[model samples]
Target: MNKKILISLATSAVLISSIYADTTSLGEITVTTATKTEKSIDGVTASVVVVTQEEIEKTGASTLDKILEKIPSINAQYARFPHPSSKSKASISLRGVGANGTLILIDGKRLSGETESPYEMTRITASMIERIEIVKGSMSTLYGSDAIGGVINIITKKIDKNETTIDIKYGSNGDGEAKNKNVNFITRAKVGTFKYKIYGNINDTTPYSISKSYSQVATNPSTGSAITTDAQHGVTGVSNVTYRDESTTKTIGTRFENDFSDNLKVGIDVNYFKENREGEYIGTAKYINSGTPILVKNTPVSSEDKNSRLDVSLDLEYFITEKLSLDTNIYRSYYKKRNYTNPINFTGPTNTKFSANVTIDGIESNLKYELNDLNFITSGIEYRKEKRESSAINPDPSSSEFITKVVKYKALFIQDEIVLNDTLNATIGARYDNISNADNKTTFQAGLVQKLGENTSLRANYAQGYRAPDIAELYVVSPSYKDGKRFGAEVIYGPKTTAYDLKPEESQTFELSLSNKYNDLSSQLTLFNTTVKDKIELVSYNDGTAAKYYTSENLDEVVIKGIEASFSYIFNDSFDLSLDATYLKTKDKSTGNELMYTPNISASIGANYQITKEFSSNLNFRYIGKQFTNSTNTTKANNYNLVDLGARYNINKHLQFYAGIDNIFDKKIEEELGTNVGRYFYTGIRVSF
Candidate 1:
C-alpha cells in the first residue's frame, strides 16, 4: 500500500475512536499568540506544542538540546562540549529551514543579544524554565523578524515563597556533570511587593580522546605538498589529541512587582551571569614520520566570559468599559558582555572577540474589545531602539577593528477572531513594520478551525512573513588570517553595501493539522509547506590561488514541505508508549533540486513501565536518516540508530535514584561531516531534593 493510504487509514481509525469517546476533558490552559490576551489553545487555528515542568522532568532531559532532539520536526547540532564561541549556542532548525529563520522569545521579550547569524544565541538555563511553547508555521503577523520558520517562547519560573530545590547530575565518557541550586522568595506584605529568585550552576568535564586514522591527503599540484590534513590510526608517526573542558555559570536575578492600583503594575528586574571555561589539549607524541618524533606537547588554556542585563518595566491595564480594555508596557534593558582568552594560538590563530555592549528601550500598547459573544478584535503598536558598540583587537593594534551600530524599529498590528458557530472559527491578522535600514513591509495571516467532534478537530493556516537583517549581520567588521599563517588582518566586510540596498527576506507558509484524543490515546499530525524569496546564503570567494573569503548574499528562492506525526497510548495503569515521526523534503526552486543536510525521514519510539509504585523503567529507540553536507550533495552521511534505557527508584519522598545510558548500541557513525565521527556511550545519575 502507498504511504498516503496508510496515513489515511490510521487517521480515520483514531478519529473514529475519538468521536465515540467524546467525554475526554478539554484543555483549559490559555495562549498569548492568537490573541493579545490569554486564549485557549483549542481555539487557536495553528499547530502548537507545550512542554510543561512535569513533562520536562519526566523526559529526563539533561540539556536543551536533548529535549529538542526528541521533537519530531526539530533538528539540532553541537560541535563539542564547552565550545569556545557560545556556551548556550545551539542551532534550532525547524522542518527543512535553517536555524536563523526561527524566532525565540524569553518571558514575552526578545533576547537581549540576538545576532543575525544562521544560528541563535540563547542562554536560558533549562532547569530554570517554567514552560516551553512551540508555535509551528509562519508568524510574521505576530513577530516582525525571524518568524519565517516558527516561534519558540520560553517562560521562566515565577517567584514562589513555598519551595526551594537543588539538583545535581554526573555522567561518564568525559561527559561533565552539573549542579543547580535555586530558591524563590516572595514577600507581599512589605513596603513594596518583593519577589526574588537566584540560581547557580556548575559544570565540569574530563578529557575525551579521539583516535587518528591514516588516510591519503589530497595533493596540491602546485606545491607537491598535501592540501589536506592526514590522520593515522593505530600506528606511530602521528599526533594523538585528547580534549578536556570545564565551565561554571552563575546567574542571580530578582524581580519586584508592585501593584500601585488595580489598574497599574510596575516591575523591576536585574540579572547577571558569570561564565568561566577552561580547555586542555594533550598529545602523546608529535611525530613527523617513523623515528622522527618531534616532541610531546600539552597545553591548558582558559577563558572567562561575563554578561549582565538589567530590565526596568512598567505595565498598566485599565478597563475602558465593561467590554473594552487597554494594556500598555514600557521597558529598558542595559546589557554588557566581555570575553577574555589566554595568550595561546588554537585553530592556528590567536582569536579573540571582546567587549560587546548594547542598550535597548521599547514600549508597546494594545487595545482589546469584545464585540459580542463570538467575536473580538485586538490592535497594538510597538517601538524599539537599540545602540551597540563593539571592538575586536588582534593584540597587534593595527589589526584591530571597531563597530558602532544604531537601529530603530516600529510596528503596528491588528488581529480578529470570529467564531462563526459552535463548530467553526476563523482568525485573520496583519502587521506592518518600518525599519531604519529599510522602508517598510506588511505581513498577513489567516487560519480556520473546524470541529469534527467533541474530541477531534481540524485546522489549517496560511501566513506571510518578512525578516530584516540583524545588527551583527548588517554592520559587523572583523579580521581573518590565512591558513595557519599569522598574516596580519584580512579585510572583513559587513552584509550591507549601501545601508538600504539589500531586500528583505520574505516567506509564505501553509499548514494543516489534525488532533484527536480517546480514553487512553492522544495523537496529532501536521503537514506544512513553506516558500521563501530572497533567501540569504553565504558565498565564498577564492582568488584562484591560496585563500578564500566568505560573505553573505541573497538567493533567488526556495521551498520546503514536511509532515510530522506523534502518537501516545496508555495501556492499563502501569505502562505507556509513544511514537513520533517526521519526513521533510526541501528544494531550491530556482535550481529545481533538493536542499542539503535535511533528512528525508527521522523517527523515535519510547516505552515506559512501572515496576512498582516507586520504581519505573524507560526505554527509547531513536533513528536518524542520512543527510548531505553540501548543496551539490557530493558527500553523504551514514544513518544510525541508538537506544537508551533507564530506571528510577525512589528511596523516599526527599530522594530518588536514576540512571540512563546514552548511545547504548555503541554505533560509530559519521554525522553530516565526512571526516568527523561521533560514537560514545554515557551513563548519568540525578539527585533531587
Candidate 2:
C-alpha cells in the first residue's frame, strides 16, 4: 500500500471517531515509569505507551518481543541472520537511537549483564508480566546510563487472590522447520499476612537451515567469476550458511511481599534463567601466501554456548508522617556465559573457549514529600558497583586474553511536580552522577502539560541524556576475523583494542505530543527530535597490514527525528479497532549518510471482534517500509507486510484454548537483512485453578 494512502486512512479514522464520540469515559490509567510516582496518564508529560495484560493475551504472543513490535516508534529485531556463534538475542531501537542507547528495567531495577544486549526481551515470558510501560525520549534524569534513548519498565503480576495457571504451547513453520515447544506454570497464594507468587517456564526450539530458500556462492578472485566446483577455485559448497541454531531455555522466579505493620511493608524477589545453544557451519577460505593467492578447503566447525542469570532484590516502604514517606531497594545480580567451539583448519583459533562473568550490586533510597496540594517533591540517593571478567583460551598460547574491569558510581537526584492550576502542570528534575573511572556528569529535564479543552491536552518536554562506555567497549582484547576479506580468503586479524581516553556519548532531546480522549475514541500524535554528540561506533582500519581490524571511536554527531501517531476506538461491546504508525529520519552528520537498519516508515492495524461470550477473534496487519542495510546506503531491504490471525475460546471458568498464525503471507526479505521465518502456526491451552 502507498504511504499516503495509509496516512490518509489513519486520519480519516480519527476524524470519524470524533464525529461519533460519546460521553463514556475510558477510565483513568495510572503509570509510574514517567515520574517514578503514580500519576494518571493524562497528567504525565512524557510520551508513554502502556500495554495491559488483556491486550497481551489478545495477541497470543509467547515472547515479549513479539508483543512490543506492534507498538509505534519501536523497531524490534529477533532471530536474525549473520549472528555470532552464541544464541540469538532480540534487540529494539527506539526512534532510531540504536539498541545500546535504551535502558530496560524489571520492577524499576536494572538487570545484570551487558547493557547492550536485550536478552530479557526474549527470555521473559508474557505470562509473567502484568503490564509494560514504555517512555520515549531521553530519560537520563530518572535513570542513569543507557537511558539516552528511552526506558522500558516491565511490571510483574501481584495477585490479590489464590490462583494457579498452567500453559502449554507447540508451534512450527509451514515446512515443519524450527519446531518449538513451551510450557509455563505460575502460582500465587497467601499465608497469613504474607503473599507470594512462584512461576517457571521452559522452552525448546530445533534448528532450521535456510539453504533451501537461499544459497551461498563463492567467487574466484583472479578470474572474477563464480566458482561452483572445488577444482575451479578450491572452494566447496557451504552448508548451514544461513541457519537458525537449536536452543533451550528455562526460567524460574518467585516474589514475596508482607505488611509487617500499618506503617511499614516489605517485599523480596528472586529469579533465575538459563539457556543453551548449539550451532554448526561448514565453509571454505582463501588467503595469500608468498605474494600468491591460494584457496583452501576449511574444516567444519561446531559450537556450544551456555548462559545463566541470577537476580535478587529487597524492597521496603515506610510512612514517617501523613505527607512523608520513604522507599528503599537493595539488589544484586550475576550473569555468566560459556562458549566452546571445535577445532578448525582455517581462521586463527582451534579448540577455542570463551567465558564471561558480570556482577552488579546497588542500593537506592527515596523520600517523597507532599509539600502542599499544588506541589510534590521527590529526592533519591543511589550507589551502584559493576564488575566484569572475561577470558578466552585457544590452542595457540600467544592469543591475548580479556582483562577484568570494575566501575562504581554514586548519584543524587531530585524532582518537583507542580500543579500550577487545574489545567496546567509542570515538572522539573536534575541528577548528578560521580563515577570512579570517568568524568562526573549532570543531566536535567523539564516538561509541561496544558489542557486545551475537556478532552484534549498538549505536552512538551526537553531532556539531556548520556551513556558511559561499558567494559566490553572500553577494555575488550579479543582477536577479530572476517570472511572473504583478502581475495576470498578469511583474514585473521590481531586482537582488537580500545582507547583509554574514550568519552561518553551525550544527547539532547525535545518532544511534543497532543492527546485527546473523548468517549470511546482515544488518540495521540507525537513529534520528537534528538541530537547526539560523540556517538560511539566501531570502525575498521588497516594497521599497515593486509588484515583489517575494528576499534571503537566517537563520531562527531548524529541526528534522529520522527513522528508517531496512534488511534483507538471502541465501536461497541463486540468490536474495536486500533491504528498506529511511525515515520523516522536519521542521519550521521560526519558521513552525511543515513544510519543503517533504520526504517523510514512502519505501521500496524488491529481489530478484535467477539462472536460470543466465550469466543473471540482478532486480526493484525503490520507493515515495515524499506530500510538501508549499510551506512553508505548502497544496499536496501525492500518493504514487507505481515498478517496475523488469532482466536480464543473459553470452555469454562477453568479452561481456555487459543490458536494463532503469524506471517500469514509468508513474506521474505534479503539475507543481508533479517530472516522472516515464513508463516508459523501455534496453538496452546491454559488451565486455571
Candidate 3:
C-alpha cells in the first residue's frame, strides 16, 4: 500500500477508536524487536513471546538454555562437539531449525560467536536479565543476516532504584553429590547526574559421562550402525571408551550512563567473559577388516581449552526535534581461544594445538519520526567489519598452521507503520545489504494485523531471508611451509565461493497466527512455512593429491513447515498453568530426506502454585520426540522426557531461600556421541538491600 492511502486509512481508524478505546484494559507489554521502537505487542503483525522477569524468577533455572527449554516452540539442546572449538559448545535451536539459523541479540547489539553455536549462555545469570523478547519469524528486513529461523532479543536488567543483591546456588546430580555451583553479585546506584550498574558471576560445573567404558558400547539395531564409538573416533564397530567434559565460566560487566540535558543522553558499557573447558574422549582403532562390524580397543584423545571474550560499547541519543529523534551505537568485540589435544594409544596425530582469534567492530545509527498519532517511520544504517585468524600445529609441522579471513559489511533499512483502522494495522519494510565477498541484495517484508474483538486477533506476514557465508566457509588457506617457502607438500585451498559456486541463501517465509485473551485464559496458534534455495552445506574436496580440504557449497532447496500452539490459564493469584506444543515437518527437497537434528514433536507443560506471597512451588515437564542425527537417516537420537521441581521461601524482605531439582527422574539420552546430563539438585539463598 502507498503512504497516502495508509495514512488516510489510519486517520479514519483514529476517529473510530474513540468509540471503544476505553472499554479495554490499558495494560499491555511493550516490545521493541517487532517494530524497532517501543510499542504494544498487539500493535505489530508479527508473533512475539515475552519471557518476563517474574517468569524467569519462578523457573528456578540459572542457565538461559534450561529456562528456554520449557517454551514449546524452542528446540533447546546442548551438546559436545566431536571436533572441539570455542564454537562447538552449548547452543539453542528454534522450531527444529539449527542454532546457526537463529540470530541472538543483547540490548539491540550483536553477540558475536562461532557460526556453529552460541557459547555465551553461562556467562550471565538469570538475575541479570529483566526480560527476553522472542520474535518468531523472518526479520531480515530489520536485521541483516541469520534471521531465517527467528530472532531472540535479550533485554538485561536496568535498575530503577538503588539496590544491591547477592545470589548463591549449589547443585548436584543425585542425593548428596556436587555437580554445579553458581555465585553472582549485582548493584546499581545513582551518583549526581550519572547512573551506574555492575554485575559479576561465576559458574562451575562438573562433567557428565554417558558410558563408563568401551565394554558398555554397542551397535544400533534400527540404523544398523554403531552408536557410541563410530561418530566420535571415525571408526565403524568397536567400543572401548570413556568420556568426560567439564566447564567453568566467569563474567563481569558494568554500565554507566548520564543525561547531559533533557534532550540528550550518553552511555558506555563494557564486559569480559572467560571460560575453561577440558574433556577426555576415548575410541577404538580404525576399522579396516572386511567384516560386519569392528571393535573398539580403548584409544582416546584428551584436550584442554581456554577461551576469553571482551566487549565494549558506546551509546548516544538526542532529540533532533519534538517529532524526530536520533539513536547511534558503536560496539567492538574480541575473542581469543586456544586448545591443546593429545592422542593416547591411537594411530593419529599427537600433541596437536589449535587456536583462533576473532575481532569484530560495528556501528549503527537510527532515526525515528512520528508523522502523526497513527503513523511511525524508522530508518537506519549499519556497518560491521570482522577478522578471523585460525592456526593449528600438528604432529607434522610441515602440514601448515595459519589461515586469516576478513569481511566488511554495510546495510540500510527503513520501516513504516500505519494504523489502518481501529482493529487493523499494517507494516512495510525493506533492507539493502552489501558484503565485500558477494553480490549486494535487497530484501522486503509486509504484514497485517486485525483485531476481531476485545478477545481475538489475527496476524499474517511475509518476509525475505538472507545469509552471508561464514568465515570458516570461505577465504581459508593452508600453505605447507618448509623453510618459509613453497614446499613439496600440497597446500590446501578453500574453493572460491562465487555467486554461482556458492550462492547466498535466499528464502521466502510466511506465517499466520490467531491469538485470544479471555477473562482467565489466553491462547495462541500459529502456522508457518518457509522455502529456501541454494542451501549451504559443507563439502569435502581432494586437492588433486593426498591432502583433502572442505568448503561450503550450495544445495538445491529446502522446505520447512510447522505449527506452534500455546495456552495459559490463571486460576487466581495463587495458581497458574501453561502448556505448549510444536509439530515440525522439514525436508531437503534435493535429496527427499528430512533435515538433521530436527525433532518431529516437542512440548512443555508447567504449573505454578503459591500458598502465600513469599512461598511458592513450580513443576515443569518437557518432551522431545524422535530425530535423526545423520543426513541419510541411518543414525537416530531417541526420544526423551524430563521433569523439574522447584520451591522458594522468604523469611523477610531481605532474606530468601530457594531449592530446585532438574531432571528429577534421572532421565538420560545418548544424543549422538555424547549424553545429556543426569538428575541434578540445587539449593541457594538470595539477599537484597
Candidate 4:
C-alpha cells in the first residue's frame, strides 16, 4: 500500500488524532468529512442512510412523496410523462431496480433522465429539501450507471444560524397547499483573511391531486352491477388526490460560502425548477342506447405539462501540506420537458411532445492522509458526462411521426478508505463505464467495519455491479399507418461493432450489519443478499391493431433477500420513539416465481410528543405488504395500512405553526386496474423571518 506510503500513514493518523482530543463529533461528519464527525453508521464501508433535517421536521411529511412512503426499503413513482401516459409519470423506484437503477442527486449534482426511469429526470422542489442521503447497496463502486439501484443525494437548504420561513396548507380531497417563503439574513464582520456565507431558497406548490374519481355510481367488485366505472368519476378518491396527477413546483435557490485563509474554502451553488401539470380519466360501456341497451361511458383524458431545470455546483478545498489535502468538484445540469395529450377513447395517436432535453457534466478529485495511530488513507477520482434529446408529434390521419435517439454516457472512478485499527475498517472501490449503447465494464467494492464494545457494531460488505441499456431500452421505435413507414426503427444492432451487444446487467452483493447504542437508545440491523445477471424484463406482443408491443429482456437470473430494521427511543428530552422495518424475498431463478412489484413486507411506526416549549406532536403508521402486478404473477396488489398526524407550534423564534393529517384511516388502496386509491388529509402553517 504505497501511494506515497499511504500518504505518510494518513498524515500520522491526522497528527495522532489531532494531538489527542476532538472526538470529531457532528455525528462523525462523513459526507466526505469537513470538521463535524460522528461517522459510525456501522463504521461505514458504505451502506449509508441519513435522513436528517430533524428527520424532515419530525415527519410532518408534506411531500418527498410523504417521506418516501415511510421508507419500506424505498420505492417511489410519480409522473409528468411516461408510459401510455400513466397520467403523467413522476416516478421514483429503488428496490425493484426500476427508476433507472435509481440514482437521483441534487447538491451532489447529476439529475435528468426519463423515458420512464433511468434516473436522470429532474424537477426538484421538496421545499428545497434539507436532507436525504439514502445510499443502500450496490453503488457501482461509487456511482456509475445509475449506481445500479442506489444513491439518492438531495441535500439542499443551508443557512446555518440566522433563518426565515413560511408554509401553509389545506387538506381533504379538494386539497390545496402552499409553500412560499424561506429567508435567511446573517452577518459577521471580519477582514484580512476574510470569511463569508450567503444562502437562499423560495419554493411553491399549487397542483396536488394525482387521481381520486367519484361523482356517484358504485358496486362492481367483479360485476356486482351498478358499475358506472372510472371509480364513479371526478374528484372522488375520497379527498386527498391533491391535484390530479400532481404538478406545480417552482423553486429558486442560491448558496455561497468562502473563507480565504483557514486551509482555504470555497463553494457556489445554484438551482431552478418549474413545473405544471394536468390529468383526467373515466370509462364505462354497454352500447346500443338507441335500441335501449344503455350504460355509456367516456371521459377520456386531457393533458398538459411543462418542466424546466438548471443546476450548477462547484466546491473546492485545499490544505496542500500539513498532511496533504485536496478536493475538487464541478457540476452542470440543464433540462426541459413538455407534454400535451387529448384522448377521449381517441383510439391510438393524438399526442404531442415538443421537446425533451438533459445534459450533465461532472468532475471530482480527493486525497487525504493521516497515517499512524493504527492506519489511515483515502483516495478518489471521478468523471461523468451525459446527454439526451427528443422531439415528437402525432395527429393521426392513420399516423406516422418521428424524432428519436441521442443518448450518451462516460464514466471513470477510484476509491479507497482504509483505517485498520481501533476495531478495524476497510474499503475499496472501482468503476469504469463507457456507454453510448454498450462496450466496457468494470465495477467492484469491498468493505468491513467492526467495533464490538461501547454499545456494539459490526459490518461486512461485498459488491460487484453493472447496469446499462436505457435509451428506451436499446432504441425503441414504433410509428404506424400499419407499416407505410412512418416509424419502425427499433434497433439492437452491434455484434461486430457500433457498440451494442447489450448484455450489461450484473450484480453480486452480500451485506450484514448490526449496530446498537444505549442511553436513550438506538438500533439497527440489516441483512442483504442480491444476485442478478442480465436481469431486465418487459415483454408483450400483440400489435395487430389494439396495440401492445413492448420488448426488453435479459432476464436469466434474479434473487433479492433482505431484512432491514431501525429503531430509536429517546424517552426523555420531550419523548420520542421510532421504528422502521422491511422484509423482502424476491426470486425468479428461472421461474421459481415470486417477483413482480416485489413486496414481501414493509412497515413503519413513529411517535413523538413534547407538549411544552412551543408544543409538538406526531404519530405515524404505515405498512404495504402484498405485491405483484404482472409477470405471470397475475395481478395482485392489496395490503394497506396508513395513518398520520402531526402538530407543531412555536409562535415565537420568528413564528412557527404546522399541521398534518394524511390518509389517517381512509384506506382504499388498490393500485393498477381497480384503483380505489386514498389520501384524505392535509393541514399546514409555517413562518419565520
Identify the leading candidate in terms of lDDT: 2
Query: After superposing candidate 1, which stretches have Cα over 4 Å from the reference?
Result: 1-26, 34-36, 77-89, 114-122, 159-161, 174-198, 203-245, 258-265, 279-322, 333-335, 340-350, 392-398, 475-501, 668-689
Q: What is the lDDT of residue 603 in candidate 1?
A: 79
lDDT of each: 0.60, 0.75, 0.70, 0.57
Off by over 4 Å in 2: 1-27, 77-83, 212-234, 281-300, 343-353, 392-402, 477-501, 542-545
- lDDT agreement of model 4 with the native: 0.57
Model 2 gets an lDDT of 0.75
Rank list by TM-score: 2, 3, 1, 4
lDDT of 3 by residue, 267-326 (tens): 999989898877665422223223433322334456677889899999999998999999
**Model 1 C-alpha lDDT per residue in residues 1-689, reported as the tens digit of each score:** 23474367447545655665566744567777545567788878877778887656555554555566667677653321112332223467677666667777666666555353212232455566678888877777877777777787877776655345555555554233322222222222234454445555443434333433322222222222333343322222332223223455555565666666665556665555555544432221122433332211222224445555665666667877878988877777766766554423222223245457777788888998898998899889989887776654222222324466778889999998989998899999999998897669999999998888787788899999787765544433322211111111122322211322445688998889887877777787888888889776543444455333334456688888877777788897899998777777778777676666567667788898999999988888877777765555677676667777777777777566666666666666562222211333333344443
Number of the top TM-score candidate: 2
Work out how many backbone clashes candidate 2 has: 1
**In candidate 2, what are the lDDT values of residues 94-193, reduced to their tens digit?**
8888777878888899888654664566677888889999998888888877788899998988767899999898888899987778899999999888
Clashes of each: 5, 1, 6, 50
Better of 1 and 4 by lDDT: 1
User: Estimated TM-score per prediction?
Assistant: 0.80, 0.89, 0.84, 0.31
